[model samples]
Target: MRRAFPWLVLFLLCLGLTPVVFAQSQSELDELRREIAELDEKIDAAEAEKSAVAGDLAVAQEEFYEAAEAVDAAQVKVDAVQAEIDTEEVQLAEIELDLDTFKTALAATEKELTETETRVVDQTAELYMATATQAPLVFEFTDTEEIALSSAYVDDALGNSAELAASLEGLRDQADRERVSLAGAREEQQTLLAALDEKRGRLQTEVDALDEVKQVEAAEMGELQALVDGINANIAAAERHKDGLEADSARIEDELARRAARQREEEQQNDGGGGDGGGAPPPGANGWVRPVPGGVSSGFGYRTHPISGARKLHTGLDMSAGCGEPIYAANGGTVVTASWYGGYGNAIIIDHGGGVATLYAHQTSFAVGSGTSVSAGQVVGYVGTTGYSTGCHLHFEVRLSGTPVDPSPYIP
Candidate 1:
């Protein structure tokens, strides 16, 4: 009976240890499940954001094209107007040359008229002097033949002078009229040239204004394009992140499943051996709570990576919380991991029993240590912009059966 007592004590200890081992396995599975959920959420968010940005970028590019077209059209009009102005200027130059010719001709005509008048005046003056000096002698001594010849000479001279004066007066009048006509033509030509110049100026102004508008529109389009590019980058990053998370979650889930199966089989063996096998632990009484009391800044899903420009999955919910803000546990659980993790930065993972778990990432500091039990709404860490984070926030995740699932359903 004494030897049987020692064997009984050993059996009791084994029975007591069995539940603890099972619980630990379950916690690990739950944590993996939570991680998967968080990754899925991140991917969804990134995809949506990328889609919106792409649409905007398309519009911007369209607008930019339109602006370019406008600029081209305006340039064409400017060219056409310039051509017209050039033609008008050529006509104006021709008219100006014609005017100069007319003035020169008029001046020559006036000079010829003045010379004829001067010659007529000189002839008349000579005839008058000859008549005064020779009239008495000619009348007293001249025979009939001589008188007839002198009278013929005086008549011929006077008649020639009168004819020359009349011709000169007609030429002068004609030349004056021609000069007036040419002046009128020149004035008309000048007016036409001015009108053409004014038209050209207006056309040029219009072109300038259109060019300015085109420039402004082009700039706006460029800005829109840049925005679109940025969005595309974000989408790609999101997708890559999502893929990574999915792979990680799958691997972890498989490991947890294998561990769980082993735990179950061991329990079955223990039971068959007549060991006291405790029943499954009860379901958690505490419901899920938000890790941070803040709006979701980045949703879990595929998004463009900001730095790498790659499509990646984001595997967690980014809460818009200030740095150093307390992060609470989503449910009562034992801390599975509490340490600096690559990209997660000061992360803490909690394992609630029954294949449920939650993760808190990018924490400035941790309040709880690994293996420590935590209650729902217990402060587990503080928010931070650490390890791949753009700003201060809480990256929260939930898992079920070691597979990541959306935390929204579980978060309040």
Candidate 2:
């Protein structure tokens, strides 16, 4: 009964304080559950905010890259235009020199024409005086008395002296000999006048030919002058375009700097890692890449045209690669062109400096864009027909300066 009393007192003490502790524990558990739910909500909200910011950053980066590429293309276009201006300037200089030369020649020719006209007038006058109206007077002397003028003169005029005395014992034989000599002199003078006329006509013909040449030069000078004017106008236009590009480039630079600052701050917040790196390595040991891993269908040089069976200039090497095969760069270079080229379809051109360039044609799609620096053996595009091709093949070209060279010489 004494032990039972002690147990009862202990149970009462426990029962009296147990409910308060249990209630306090339940309140703490509920508060902890509510705190956990709030934390999860905050986490979802933070993740959404991060995703939106990242999207904005990605959009800005894309715009920056596009703007940069456009500016680069504009710069290249401006450079080409400037080069054209330089070429035109040189042409204009040569034209000016030619114009000066032609002008001088024209002046000399005009002087020659005037001299020829004067000579023709003078020669005509001289010929008229020498050939016309001067009919030689034939004097017929009729004498009634037949006197022996000279015995020796009469003998010379006759066939023989004895024959002459038998034939004519008068001075009639001497008069006939004198008449023959005068006729010979008149015939000789007329022959000389005729020869002079022929020479004058030939000279006038030469003069006329020269006059025609001068007229052609005068017409050519007019054309050259017009071309020079057009070239100068183009030069002025190019200068204006350059100025506008410069201003645009300055604005772009300012924007790029601001974007870069923002990117740096964002990077500090998120740490490293930005931009999806999408560039290509260049060609190296494999100087020549298989355009389509197929047989060489045609070589670069003169050959029979497949369509015409006639001799033609084969501008490039043709390979029988399958469609959609990766087209790699033959050497280390930058992609200078990636667009539809004449006869080349969807083509890609790489500039390997030192005035060397290579071309890949008949592409389905390009893996890289213009101005992208590439390494050897890097895939730049895929093979397909998009130009003047009859089949799925790659048209490859090796160029020195701007002239097509034998690709076989460089192929590995």
Q: After superposition, how far is residue 385 of candidate 2 from its true place, in Å?
A: 1.3
Best by TM-score: 1
Tens digits of per-residue lDDT, candidate 1, 1-412, equal 0011223233223223111111223234334333434434444554555466556656656765776687677667767767877777777778778778877887887788888877876886787567758765656655986678567766767697887877887887887787787678768767776776777677777767767766765676666556546545544554454455445544543454465446545866877732111221222334566677788877878988653467887777778888656677777889999986766756899999899888898765666689998877776766765455556778888878877777776776
Q: Which candidate is the best by lDDT?
A: 1
Q: Write model 2 residue lDDT over 42-75, tens digit each, in one string.
A: 3343344444444544554454455555545555
lDDT of 2: 0.55
The residue ranges of model 1 lying beyond 4 angstroms of the native Cα positions read 1-87, 136-160, 273-412
Each model's backbone clash number? 48, 8
